[model samples]
Target chain A: MVKTYVFGHKSPDSDSITSSLVMTNLEKELGNTEVQAYRLGNINKETEFILNYLDIDAPELLENIEDDANVILVDHNSPSESVENLENANILKVVDHHKLALKTSYPLFLRFEPVGCTETILCKLYEENNVEITKEMATLMLSAIISDTLLLKSPTTTEDDKKAVTKLSKIAEIDVEEYGLKMLKAGTDLSSFSIEEILALDAKQIDFKNVKSIVNQVNTASIPDVLEMKDELEEGMNKIIEKENLDLFMLLITDIVNSNSQVIALGKNADLVEKSYDIKLEDNMVLLEGVVSRKKQVVPIMTENA
Target chain B: MVKTYVFGHKSPDSDSITSSLVMTNLEKELGNTEVQAYRLGNINKETEFILNYLDIDAPELLENIEDDANVILVDHNSPSESVENLENANILKVVDHHKLALKTSYPLFLRFEPVGCTETILCKLYEENNVEITKEMATLMLSAIISDTLLLKSPTTTEDDKKAVTKLSKIAEIDVEEYGLKMLKAGTDLSSFSIEEILALDAKQIDFKNVKSIVNQVNTASIPDVLEMKDELEEGMNKIIEKENLDLFMLLITDIVNSNSQVIALGKNADLVEKSYDIKLEDNMVLLEGVVSRKKQVVPIMTENA
Candidate 1:
């Protein structure tokens, strides 16, 4: 039996979880192999809401895969964001929207589009393959598009994503104004998450020439609400910096409504953010107006500075 | 005007040089952007002979490319094999037969096959794109395949390569045995090359955990004839080990006619060859019964041992 595990990057977002399931279904519909959907971490609240709404069971949690396990990656190709021991796995296929940072010994199928979400690319694949999108799949895909594009407000949003959202919303019969806001608000609830959990919720590690750093982002309706917990977040970030021996740790608390961000930077290389944005990082805090997308705005600036 | 540079890895081989030209031709015929073929290094003797035979000009040499300069890679994908500053370039497409060891920031077209030669994959692409393969183009591509697969005798040779050879030979209108022997003989002439030049010819760097190594292979009809220069070769290898800070440096004097290899293992991890192949290294030399294909035989075993 040919078994292939399909998964996305760690710190599972809605796009990552939904795209894995969508890709597995499409692979099965093609009738080549036995593909199983998997998640690298606990599903976020927004993703949980979508899954519960569709009544689809969450994928199995995968901590580690074997060296030669046949796998298909979705949503991400960065080794930093992928599962541990990803370099050793036999990657069979990849469907992603992010920058490619993966290298394999052998060639495999890869379909990447510079869109907001992996599900947008999957939507095109589904159409090209003549696979019908079910109501539940449509709902989940639409949710992912909205989550990633921030209801088409993010810099990463593209014409392809807008097209996918419009078509998928019709199929899923969801009001864009009603369901998108509800879903985004669902993910903003930080009451249950500890400071540690919050730091790791959507964290990504990046390696610079001489420094290693972790950058985490959380979207909220009110960025000041998250800032109220800044002291606790800094404490948690410092503990993580010590544990991972990181050069820098950054937390970007983004306001979806205002399209601004409040950053809490810590660690030795925390000055990088200050230099990148030309702002004084007083008490490791800075408010940047009109900055939202991590991939478009934050990473490029930090990478240039680093 | 849109400009794209097409090239292969450093220490360029016949396949690397020829495939770049062939891919450029194919891309242009398909009516894409303006694509220019380039060589990462000077063309080898065998490639020069083939280019002269067809009266085709060798591609311009490229040392480095600007960040986001569009590039289409051939024969290789590893940053180690590609142009300097490859990580910064915007990779538009890749046509390779080697293991996938590339990561890009955005999605691009990639046509990769696990065949013995990159030209074998390019042959299919030309057909798929409905582009006419000229006579001179056919000769260069066939020369590349013969060089890489050793006239379809190397272990790395696949059915796809054999099929490509048969079809390409028809297009080029050449007697395979006569031309293949002449081409192979031309590359075996090391009379003018210094020890340093010989070591740099077709060398590949491999980074294993806790060790960095360089593997260089030279094909000859008589292994003993090449071994006569073993002392000079070892001295050169030691110099390279120090220069590159490598833990291991290996030189394979492959007897092409007999399909066997004599290895000159040097550096700190020279014992790895002994451990991997269950052989005792006398004066850091060992004769392997049949080890013509470095991709199929040497890399995997050495990687396992390392």
Candidate 2:
């Protein structure tokens, strides 16, 4: 039997893990017992809670798709080439929110719908498969829906998220607003780790021919707190830079307080960043006003300038 | 008019440029008059020759799409989220080969099937639209098909590539094999610039809590040549590391001989690299047996063992 491995984007959250788990059970119901779910990235505390509360075995952690497995990727890699690295395995399916890349190989079946969370799509599958939505699966999906949609505040939110909340609340035996608030509260633990750890969690690698470096940002609910962590963030960045001997170093500290990001770029051409952003450095930070969203707001300006 | 900017992947080749240009014309015939084509990466020699032969203006070079334009990413990004970015735009259409991402915002009006090149998909679109395929467009689409499919030797090759080649050869009036060889020759110009200049392309930032350093890599087509360039690569890495005062450093001199890569991971862990790859250090090179494809073979191992 060809075993199937399920995974989500790098640094997966509640929705990815829960949906894959629910979907794996749903797949078994559909007569595919070889599918096993895995996490492409590390799991956070809140997702851990929902999984533990329901007593679901936490999926194994995998760093890259290059590992040996027939993988089903979710969340981050758009089309699949980014995640289709295993040479000998087959990619049976994919479920994600990001745009797809040019394909590596077409799936036996693929379901990609741009919604706030993967769990919403999987919930529908769970319902379709009539795999009696267990309380644990419901809670997992519920927490996932909450974190990804940002309590339905993100621009990416859709009617499906609202629907998922309603359906999941009933199934999981919880109040929607109260659960959402609690999950968000649990997810927003900024002080649990130093600025460096927070930065690495959301870090992305930027490859330019000969030069390659990672850029990381931290989106905070409280910018004042982010400021407080600034010293640690800087210290962490400096240490990593020294350890890795990077060509350039940077961190985008978005003050949840001011709803803006203070960008600090370091390198020989660190000055080039000033030219790239069309902003003058003020007290060691590029003051980007109204830059709250890491992907929509900050990345756009960087791309436009690059 | 909402102008559509078309482009291809960075570190571009023949496929990236031509496909975008041809697609530009195809969109025009489809009555989308505001289609603008651009190159997301540098125009490689192969593409330069193809464009010069067709007497077309090469698209402007773009280093990254991380935040650039509102770029109309073709055959890049996850397919499901392809049009998510097009949320604000009145998306005229999408052409790609990568896997699809989920987008449930509404409905998709125009989408092409996944294939080897964006140009291959464009050919189908042109035929379906019952429009004229210009000589310039034909050359571009053909070159794109040829380059992306690696002259039909790659696993991704399809019958569409052969069909595109036949049609394109009649229009472009050139023997593609000879042209492809010449383009490949031009591509292997090795390096005309210093290793320092080359390393600046994709330099990244690293943070280890309190310390900071920059990391860089120099990718080459040949291993012996990379080794020949060893002095150059090393001097460059050292100068940058020292000038930047980096605490640790490593340079990989990968040999792309017979689809195998030998890495020279120098720095503090340089001593232990031999243990990671099970390679005996032979004169400053950590010889990795049967290791090829830097993106696939090397990075994952390093991230794990490092």
Winner by TM-score: 1
Q: Write the per-residue lDDT of candidate 1 for residues B1-306, one digit (tens) a residue.
A: 578999988999999999888988888887865889999886778887898898889999997888878898888888888888888888887777766677654556666666899999888777755688889889989999999999999998999899999999999999988999899878888888899899998999986556699989998988888988988999999999999999999899988788899999999898999998999999999998889988889887877778
Worst 10 residues of 2 chain B by lDDT: B101-110
Candidate that would win on DockQ: 1
| Poorly placed runs, candidate 2 (over 4 Å) | A52-55, A63-68, A78-88, A102-108, A124-133, A190-196, A207-213, A242-250, A253-264, A267-278, A286-290, B1-306
Docking class of 2: incorrect
**TM-score, first chain, each model:** 0.97, 0.78
Evaluate residue A44 in candidate 1 and report its C-alpha lDDT on the 0 to 100 scale: 83
Q: Put down candidate 2 lDDT per residue, A101-181, tens digits, no spaces.
A: 424423223455557777887786666445788777788788888776666665557898889888988989988777666
Candidate 1: clashing pairs of residues: A104-B100, A105-B99
Candidate 1 lDDT over residue span A76-119, tens digit each: 88877888888788888888877668776555666676788899
